[model samples]
Target: MAAGAGALAPVPGVPSASLHEFPYPPQTRPRVSGGSPAGGVPPATDLVLGATAGCLACVLTNPLEVVKTRLQLQGELQPPGTYPRPYRGVLRALGAVCRADGLRGLQKGLAASLLYQGLMNGVRFYCYSHAEDAGWTRYPGGTVAAGAIAGAVGAFVGSPAYLVKTHLQAQTLSSVAVGHQHNHESISGAFESIYRQHGVAGLWRGVTGAVPRVAVGSAAQLATFASAKDWVCEHQWFREGSWAAVLAGGMVSGVAVAVTMTPFDVVSTRLYNQPVDADGTGKLYRGFLDCVLQISSKEGLLGLYKGIGAVYLRLGPHTVLSLFFWDELRKMVQHQQPPGP
Candidate 1:
C-alpha cells in the first residue's frame, strides 16, 4: 500500500474501484525512510502531534461545545412539549450563554477540554498510527477496529477530564442553566470536589457513556476520512497532496461522524453531568443502558439527538482542523528524517 505510484484516475466508463484495490494516493502514502516503516512517526511524537492538534482545535471550537452541552441538557428528562426550552437552537443557545455569562461563558471548561482532548487524541492517534506502521490496518475491517480500539483507550484515559469538562460546561447561570449543575468554580475545583465526595472512582463515573461515544465516533471519522480521501483522489477531484482534497475528505467524514456520534454524545454528556448520590452512584442513571432507556422512554428517541446541529457545527470544524493539522505535522516530521540506504 505504501509503495503506490501517483494517483490513478478511474478509467472512462469504468466503475470506481474499492479501497482494497487502492489504499491511498501515492502522495498520501507514508514513504519509508531510515529505519522507520512507511516513514512512520516515532510513537511519542505521534502522541504529541495528535494532542497538539486536538488542543488547538478545541480552543477554537469550545464555544460551540458549550452550546451543544447546554442544548443537550436543556430539557433533560422532560417529555417533548412539556418543558419550556430555553435553548431552542444553536444561535439561541449561544445568545443565551452570552447574555447570562458574557463572552467568557463560551470558554467555560477550557482547561478540562484541553486536558481531555490532549490525552484522548494523543493516545488515539498514537495507537492508530502505530497500527498502520505495523501493517495491521492492511487487513479488511482492520481500520475500523483499530480506530474503535484507539478511541476506546483514549476515551478511557481522558474520561476523568471529560467528566469534569461536562460539569463545567453545564454550569450556567440560573436563567439559562440546564441539567444538574455542579457549580464548579474551575477545573481544579471540580476535580477536587469529585475526589473529595466520591474518592478516585468518582472521577471516572461517566466512562461507561464515554467509551461507546468515542469508539463509534472514531471508527466513523477515521474510516470515512480514509475512504473519502481515496475517493476524492480516484475521482480526480483534486491534485495529489492538494489541501483541497484533505478539506473535502474531512468535510465528508464530519457528516458521517456527526450522525453516528450525536446520540452517544448526548448520552455521555448527561451521564457525566448528572447528580450523584452520596455513595457516588448516579442519581438519575444507574448505568449507560439505563440512561439510554430512560431518555428514550421519557424524552423520546429524538432526545438522544438533542443539540445535533450544535454538535455538527462544533464537530465538523473540529474534525477538519484536528485531522488537517495532524496530517500536516506528520508530513513535516517525516520530511525532516533522513532517508534510508
Candidate 2:
C-alpha cells in the first residue's frame, strides 16, 4: 500500500498541470526572435526610401521614358509627305533620339517625371506601410486591397505631373518630327501652357484611364510581393536571410505590375498623346470607356495593349530596382537606429 501511494504522487520532474488546477503561475512561452519576423519595412522609412529611389530612377531613365512616349504617340496627323519613323525597341529608340535630337531630347520631361515618380512612389510606400501596420500585411488579400487604395490616391495626386510629363515628351518628338510647336520650354512651361489653353481640365486629360491602371497595378504588385515573400520565408532555402526576401519580393512585384496594368497603360498613353483642337472637340476618347471601345473598334483588341511589351520592358526593371534599393536603404536606416531606454 505504501509503495502504491508513493507511486500515485506527482512524478519528480513532471506536474499534472491543468488550466483549472495548476498550482503555480502559467509558464511564459519563449518568443522566437532574430530579425524582424514580421517581414515589413517601417512606414516612414519606406516612404523616404521609395521616394529617393523613384527620384533617382527618374533621373537615370528619363531619356528612355521620353523616347518611349514619342514612339507610342507617333503616327497620323503629322505634316504631309514626311514619312513618320517607328522605333524598333527601347535601345533602338534611344539611339534614334540621340542621333536626331542629341542627349537633351532624351531628358525632355525630366522635371515632370521626377516630380511624378517621386510623389507617386512616396504615397505608395507610405500607404503600403501604414496599411501593413493596420494588419493588411497578414494576408495576401489585405495587401492587395490596401495597395489598390494607395495606388488610386497616389494616381490622383500625381496626375497633373503625369499629364505634364507626357506632354513634354510628346512635344520633343512633335517639334522635331512633325513641325508642330508649342510654347512650353520646360515642365513648368508645359503646365502653364496647358492651363492657359484649356484651364484646369487640361491637366487631367487622361485621368479616367490612369486611375484603374494605377489601382490594378499597385494591388498586383503588393499582393505578389507579400505572397512571394511568405512563400520564400517558408522554404528552407530562403528561411535564413532577408536578402532573399527582398529579391523575391521585388521580382514578383515587377511581374505583377507589368502584367496587370498593360492595357490601361496603353489607353493612358494614347489619351495623353492625342491631338486636341482649339475648341477641345477633337478628343479621341470621350472617357475611359469610350477610349477602350474606340480602340477595340478601330484597332482591335490588341490595340488596347499596343505598347504593353515596351511597358513591361520599362516597368519591370524600374520596379525591381526601386523595391530592391528601397529595401536595402530601409535596412540601413533601421540598423542606424539607437536602442531605446
Candidate 3:
C-alpha cells in the first residue's frame, strides 16, 4: 500500500503545465532546492534575516499595535453598549491616545515590541523558510501545520516579551502622569517588577493565549502568502520575486491573518494586560476558557471580534514590510550563493 501510494503521489518538484493541471501556480514551482537536505535544516542566516526584518517592521507599526491593544482591552467582559469605551473608533482611538498620553504614548512598548518581534518572527519565518524549501508548503494542510508549529514555538519562547509588550501598550497614560502611573520604563525594569511581584512564572503570563493567536495567524499568513504569490506568478500578475508580487502576496496574507487571528489576539491582549491578583491569578480572566465564556456571556459574540478593524490596519502593513524585507533579503543571499554541483 505504501509503495502504491508513493507511485500515485504527485512529484512535488514538478510545476503544473497549465491551470487545468494545478489549481494554482507555484511562484517558480518546486525546485531541486526543495529536495530534503541531509540535515533538513534551513540556514541560520535566514533566521537572522527574518528577525531583523520583523524588528524593523515592528518598530514601524508599534503605535498602531498600541492603539489596537488599548481598544481590545477597553470593554473586556462588559455588556455590549454598557462599557465605557473611551476611544470611539480607529481614528478616534488614535487621536484619543495621543491627546491623553502624548505622541510618545503611541509608541509605548517599542523595546518590548522589538524584542518580541525579533524572537517570535525569527522562529516563525525560520520554520516557514525551512518548510517552504523542504516542499512542505506544496500542500495546503502541510503549510498550515508547518506554520502552526513554528508560530507556537515562537510564541512560547517570546511569551515574556509579549507579556511585557501587551502590558505597556494597554496602559492609558493619564495626562497628569501622577500617583504611580503604570510606566514600563525599561524592559529590565518590567522583567524585574513582574518577577518580584509574581515570581518567574509571571513573565510568561499569557503564553497559552499567545500560542493559538500566533499559530493561527502564522498559518494563515504563510499559506495565503504562498498561494497569492503563486496565483500572481501563474497568471503573470507580477514578476517572480519582484516587489509587486511580494506586496500583493503580503496584502492577501495580512487580511487572512487578521481575520483568522483577531479573536485569539484579543484574548491574548486581555490575558496579558489583566491585573494579576495576590494569588498570581488573573483578576478579570481565570484562563483562556473563562475569558472566552465571560466575554461571550457579558459582551456578546461580537466581543470576541472587538477591534477587528484595528487589527487589520496594523497587520496589513506589518505583513507587507516584514515579508518584503525577508523576500528581498533571501533573494540577495540566494543570488550570492555559489553554483551547486
What ranking emerges by TM-score with the best candidate at the front? Answer: 1, 3, 2
Please write out the lDDT profile of model 1 over residues 191-263, one tens digit for every residue. Answer: 9999999999999998998988988887776566656765787899876456676666556656777788888
Pairs in clash, predicted candidate 2: none
- The CA lDDT at 48 in model 1 is 98
The top-ranked prediction according to TM-score is 1
Q: RMSD in angstroms, all models?
A: 5.9, 15.1, 7.5
Candidate achieving the largest lDDT: 1
- What lDDT score is found at residue 321 in candidate 2? 54
- Screening candidate 1 with a backbone cut-off below 3 angstroms (N, C-alpha, C), the clashing residue pairs are 34-340
Q: What lDDT does the true structure give each of the candidates?
A: 0.75, 0.59, 0.67
How close to the true structure is residue 53 of candidate 2, measured as C-alpha lDDT?
A: 69
State the lDDT of candidate 2 residue by residue for 278-311, as single tens digits.
7554356677787778767665675555444456
Q: Could you give candidate 3's per-residue lDDT for residues 239-317 as a string of tens digits?
A: 7656667566556556666778888887888888887787679877889888888888888888888877788777656
> What's the lDDT for candidate 1?
0.75
Candidate numbers, best lDDT first, in rank order:
1, 3, 2
